[model samples]
Target chain A: MAKFSGVWATFEYLDEMSHAVEKIREKGKKPTVLSPCPRHEIDHALGEPQTRLPFISLFAGMLGCLTGYSFTAWTASDWVLPVSGKPIVAIPPFTIIGFELTILFTALFTLAGMVLLGVIDTLRHPLPPAVKKYTRFQRDRFGVVVDCDPAQTQDFEEIFKSYGAEEVHIENN
Target chain B: MSGTTFTYGKINDDMLRMLERPHPSYFLLLLGFLTALGLGVLSLAVQVNVGIGYSGINHPIAWGVYITNFVFWIGIGHAGTLISAVFYLTRAPWRTAIYRAAEAMTVFAVMTAGLFPLLHTGRPWLAYWLIPYPNQRMLWVNFKSPLAWDVFAVSTYMTVSILFFMIGLIPDIAILRDEAIRKGQKLRAMIFTPLSLFWRGTNYQWMHYMRAYLIYAAIATPLVFSVHSIVSWDFAMSSIPGWHTTIFAPYFVAGAIFSGLAMVMTVLIPVRVVFGLEDYITDHVVQSVCRVIIFTSIIVGYAYATEFFIGWYSGSPFEKAIFYFRPFGLMEEWTLTGEQSIGFPQIAFFLMVFCNVIAPIPLWRWKIRNNLVAVWIICGLINVGMWFERFNIVGSSLQREFLPAAWGSYWPTVVEFGITVGSFGFFFTLFSLFVKALPPMAIMELKEAAHPPMKKEAHG
Candidate 1:
């Protein structure tokens, strides 16, 4: 028999996604989140390293900066548009282009960061049968779970409940 | 907390008596409003007859009194949102008693402000000319015109501000409606019944109400800063010499808020005294306002210096001339032109800086900022100073532009002056009505402020 357990807490504090990571790391179980914009401080309480994606914004901004300056430089001097007598290496004017690029890329990176870090649909993962009955894991409760096997299942329910799991169940495969 | 609880030092028996009985002292307010409205009507007709020309506008100094009044009202509008969103976000407890009046101030000031640009227009009827969509006239509004952006900014600012005021009012309206119905007060119950929208303070309603309120608050805080910055841009973005400054957007905004907060003090001091809401408003609230005024004043001072510094740095002689001519320039001093000090826009600049910046520092003391008399006086000075800033910026910059030959002074005719007074009245009239219409405090939020939301970890 497989063991089942769930974690529940309000959206900000015991956030499902943050909980899922802890379960998988600590006890080989998956955790989940049921809300948006969980508090930053709660990441520590949940024991999950901040791993999602705001850094992509910085990376994209830097990349956009280089691309913007390069394009501006090339168009003004390298490509040789002979129709007008515009200055080559116009750094002041290109600064405006750089500023615009920085804003555009930073915004795009923030959107990309959210998609990559958090799974939108919680049910798609292929975990062991133990997590199937733990749908309440995303509710207003917080629990830490450990997967137990029949060989180690001596009073498994009591042990899990003592550690603050609201409910524990066995899944038959 | 003292007996007066919040606003005044103590809640005296007389204050309770004043609140209970409808004394003529309180009723005299209706007379003030009527006189204000009557003056406004008569002056408006005269203003229309004489045209904007009689108000002392010329080609170069075209923006004069009307723009000054616009910036002033917009600045007056700032304190409402500041108290509502920023104070709410930071969880300032005292915001409960003061936020409603501030929001009312915001709505009225915006209404007053929206009129000035129309007044500034040569053809106020063609005010609709700012609209972008092609009409029978078939001419598209120039997207690049700063004025066109203003039409969008001011209208949107008014819409959002009204919504924020209304959203904040809903629960209080329900409370008042209930009180009126129970007491058998006909007029109030009739006025507020439909507006209550069937609120019963259920958990579900509170949840959704809170969510919507937070969203509006979030939107308003940014809008407060952005709206005036857009107004300042109408001046700063132009290639005109004194008008072109990068620092202007922020400077204008800070000054706007500073003056706005000062106006709040001015209005509230009288309100607290007259209504005897001593327990509702307090010395600490006054002190907090003083602190904000000080902070914004310093920034306003910093902006003044930076403008001169940037002009020097840019090394554009035209820019340099514009800056120099502003205060110290002989041409700016009306004595040189043989006009009275009234026509000297430079006088407006000096007074603006003096009132908005220099005059408020003594409030750093526990005595001055907390003293009702001192605070009221300072608030009045700040009002004067802020009005000067707009005059200095809008009028002087136009007066001392690149084309020296085109420059002339503006002098507001009696009609213009009377209308300006009327706008102030209009602003206050709306504010007074709002005071009576709803509880001035966010009673729901007060619960959380008095007691922090219980963390689930407490149970854990």
Candidate 2:
């Protein structure tokens, strides 16, 4: 009997990999699909919820707009040195500043949100040693990791092999 | 191999191989650019030590080649964003193979453009005074000025462009890292490991990455227009006869994309041949850029016609006088030097017309656009024309001011020419290193656009 933490399956074909993922879900087990590139089919097979990254960008953009406008206006009013007979707080020109800040904050926040989510997921489920050993997931192969009892590793391996997985192995942590 | 048969392994093998050590000729190219940049630095040092008078700029023409180059480089950056962000949003398939290099161009071009202002100010160290920072002096920048708007617009554009470019490179860098690790190259792995940001290509990473990338495209699309619009406002907001026109914003935006696309082709065509990336950057990609140049050329031509019409129709003597001076101001006495020579304005105006409006027309013919040699020549001419376009806008108008007494023909000195050539050196040197250092093509996105390797062929 083999003592293992999980089972890893690698596939060269997107269709085979996606089908294997569907089978894992049908067996009431969660599996994470890995690939060199994002696939619409794999995304559909995973059935994950829509990402909330946009809301993060939107909120930050609004905050940035307020900050840009208020900062310019506050600094302008602080010195009341009117020039060219224009108002102390001009809205038209300041709108350009506000618009630029809105984009700047939106892009930065979106990137930060992505890094944060990636880090959180990485912390929760550290990559297995086998993943480090076999890096095809970052190059060409599509991979799925299924956690199961040590005794059931064979069963998962059989399921993966049946769905055209090129390699199946028991990953010990 | 055929396009449909391109597998993931082949894509990796092809792109990552570019990262290997380059030929000695690559270093020679880099050295050439560095030499140019050194000359520019020396000229700038001399100017700073002596005075700003080393350049052609004076009382009437306070803005000269530096401002022209500033606008030219900024305009050159626009097409990169347009290609990367705008094409992405539109789902243009051809963009995948080219967007990575284009985005890199945008960042480098903007960085090159940013240097002009610092150089022009003479006191580059005190350039921070333009920023709206809290200080003991309590001197706030005048918010009403277009120059103030430029500080925010350009800085924000630079920051956002860099972020966008870095985000796009994440997946590609991950591939490079993993390849290095697999090959047991300790040093390369060490360098790329952190740059990849620990991307393991999990479903979660892809989901969030795709969403965020789309949002970045959305935000950057507007910047493609706004940045150049703000740049044009530096001239438009002025009450000068030729600069104060409502058409300046759109006209400048169109010209920016036009010149930017030309520059992309100008670089990419040679790169494709030298790198032997004929499969990736194909004739189809070159043709697409040529078509865009044709469309933009028409808009630029129309804008030229409209400027002349408005000058004649508005009945403003100053506008008509400046418009006349642009193409017909050959009077030797009109020059500040008072030498018996042709003025720079007329020469630049006609050359601008010949290169920008006339040269690109042949691209409309499929045969000409497909010919790489012809396309390359046309692109080069467009670049030259766009620079003159800026020169015409900045120089000609300032030369023929409302009061002829205040008008002067600005002649560029060797130092100004050196600095101008040096800016190109700076851009090319950074870009030349970038091509060897990073994946010039978007590896992951190219795979996405291609057929996925399958047990069986599945076509969408």
Candidate that would win on DockQ = 2
Q: Report the number of the highest-lDDT candidate.
A: 2
Candidate 2 residue spans exceeding 4 A from truth: A1-4, B330-339, B457-460
lDDT of 2: 0.89
Which pairs, if any, clash in model 2?
none
Q: Quality of candidate 2's docking, in CAPRI categories?
A: medium
Q: Highest TM-score: which candidate?
A: 2
Q: Which runs of model 1 end up more than 4 angstroms from their true locations?
A: A1-173, B1-21, B329-342, B447-460
TM-score (2 decimals) of chain A in model 2: 0.91
Per-residue lDDT of A1-173 in model 1, one digit per residue for the tens? 22343322222233333433354446543333221112332344345333424356568768867865775565445334332454556665455445445544544444344333333222232234433222222112333333345654444444444434445454334
- iRMSD, all candidates: 13.7, 1.1
Q: What RMSD does each model have against the real structure? A: 11.3, 2.3
lDDT tens readout by residue for model 2, A113-143: 9999877766655556677668788889998
